[model samples]
Target: MTSHAQSQAIAPKGISRFIPILSIGVLFFIFGFITWLNGALIPFLQMVCELSEMQALFIAFCFYIAYVVMALPMAKILEKTGYQKGMSVGLGIIAIGCVLFVPAALTALFPVFLLAQFVVGSGLTILQTASNPFIVRLGNEESAAARIAFMGLLNKAAGVLAPIVFTTLVLSGLPEVNQELLNTLPEMERAALINDMSVSLIQPYVGMAVALGLLALVFMRLPLPVIEDNTVASVDTLSPASQNTQIWQYPHLVLGAISLFFYVGVEVIAGDTIGLYGSSIGVENATTLTSFTMVAMVLGYALGLLTIPRFVSQQAALLGSAVTGFIVTLGIVFADDSSLLISEILWGWTGIQQLPDTVTLIALLGFANAMVWPAIWPLALKDLGKYTAQGSALLIMGIAGGAILPVVYGGLSGLTGGQLAYMVMLPCYCFIGYYALWGCRKYTW
Candidate 1:
């Protein structure tokens, strides 16, 4: 072959390196789709199952707590099987979980649904354990932020679409349907109608199971490179020796972890509770407002895609986002109870208009949360060499903050009412702000 033709052949081979990373992005999309659907599910399940606020939030607890419970074991599993096999196994587990929804829906049993969600989350823990470190190891460490940012776009885009799709199917027109059924039906028929409504979830989960199965088959066929963890035991980033080694031992990683935890909590709150919050403040049709939250998240992902690396530093993006989060929290706190200011600022730019104040603020939180995960993961995993996988596992565990913080918000809403209950978000943003500033700086140890 001519030298130029040989170069062209090698170029495509080099481009193949990105295929694994791109596949990881697809996994991220699946994760986001499942995770963000909790926003719609919490309220829908609450009404169907007749749950209290605290009880409803158990949806989040069930889903996210799996990360904490399963991260280490998942890491070990990945170590034994390698990324490709581990990912296929994880997807299989998730498919099983999705299938579990059939029984859960048939019984209209809330705890059964929670159990299925936990199982799905356990599977996701394994997927994230493999995918995160895989992306970081794909290329230059310094450029990890940009790659993660690209993944973030895929992840959040799924997050944006999930609520809109699920709500439309399950919750959007339920009241009207219920009203029509009530007018024409006897008491026995009314009970059957309500039960049938809850059971509608079965078909959606069946579709999810089929999609997961196809993705698993495809992932099994893909060519994925394995990246070994190379950090020394004594020098491990998350080791006990490293624990007493001062917070500065890995300033960027620790701060990034903290930022990730708080960012997740805030994002969960925004997406999960906004619909309920809208009801509390007298928005007539609350579930419809959930779209504004997804739209806001989509806008943030769009901005990150355009602006990260080329237009701005990840650190700067994080800092600015933290400040905006703080401001939005304050707006939620002090804004007029009935004003559309929050919704206007969040969705008005897109020609979506007159959203409820609660939803608007929730959507705006999406912007503050946009760059956080992408920025923090790259910074945390930097220079970890061998411990990169374990560190990534720990970061995945930090997702439990989503489980915890929303329950706290729900409890606060129960005690103090929903509008004022947003006070909980203030402290989360405070921690994020701290991480963005002094927390993300270099370590000497």
Candidate 2:
């Protein structure tokens, strides 16, 4: 096949399509808000439920591992429902999960809350499967990373909002609460205070449920142009190499899936675990650090959108991001875990900034972490042809790493302490660096 045919295969039209693309971008924005909020929730749940580090991080395990259990099934479901209907259905499922949170909060039951997270993750699994590939297929294959970066702009923007909003609502006065906990308060009164705090959780989830429900209805009525995986081989024209019955035979896709596993793991470690790490180190504003991370990510995505293929190839961008991630991982681990105070940040725009040396290093990771997904999705999904969804399922399932790493970090932090636990992220980035430098191009057929 000529380059021209390949281009034709991927690009359905000469014009830049808007509605479907923007719609999917909005979905990804929701994804960022939901996924990254776990950072704040880690500490919040730990304090509220009076659980240990291991138990609190089970929030990540319950939430992200659902992607593994649901990804393949979502792929199959999308085949029947198609992307548009599948997304609407997925939104509905998320709304149901959001509603489940109300009762979980009412009972103050941790397991019930995990159930809600799993349900929400299941819905997100469907949305991710339907949307990532759909968005990638809409434009020029060479510029796919740039397009995804545009969505990342929206995504991290929401990520920036989620932590600030969630922590402000759910974790407000947490410092005072901790200080009060150190004093003698009546047990019954303390329990009453905790329950009142739990009520704060109810309103936010109610708002999410209503938003998701409305979005589902909007998608049902909206007419999106029909889309297909342009990157997939027709299977009809499958040569012996392409005709392999197993998706694993596509070495790039398999490695890509594995890469995503580590990518997500490290990304979560940087964003989610940092809050707890910050709190452990006595940063009063630790709950809001995820916003700083998200801001850094937005900067990275902005750079990616501006520079990719124009200033840097996607593979080169990945290589740089991985190297930066590895170095930041080292910095976070080896840095002095000391705390400092600042009266103003952003030229006195924000009132106070609590700078923990280790926390700052971890948050800097958002810059290193931003370009990985944009690069990974396009590289892994490259030329999967008819196996696109199958390959996508495996990659989505790799999100289970989010479940694995944070819990490991929690355990390691419990054992060796917070700063040392970040060493776990080092090898994760080394593998990512390896992929960007080698794996994506190693088995080109």
Listed per model in order, the count of residue pairs whose N, CA or C atoms clash below 3 Å is 3, 2
Runs in model 1 deviating more than 4 A are: 1-15, 171-190, 231-252, 342-353, 442-445
Q: Best-fitting candidate, measured by TM-score?
A: 2
lDDT of 2 by residue, 36-86 (tens): 888777777776677877898999899999999999899999888888899
**All candidates' TM-scores?**
0.87, 0.92
Q: Model-by-model lDDT, in order? A: 0.75, 0.82
Candidate 2 stretches with Cα past 4 Å from truth are: 1-16, 171-175, 179-184, 230-240, 339-352
Model 1, CA-based lDDT: 0.75
TM-score for candidate 2, please give it. 0.92
Clashes counted in candidate 1 amount to 3
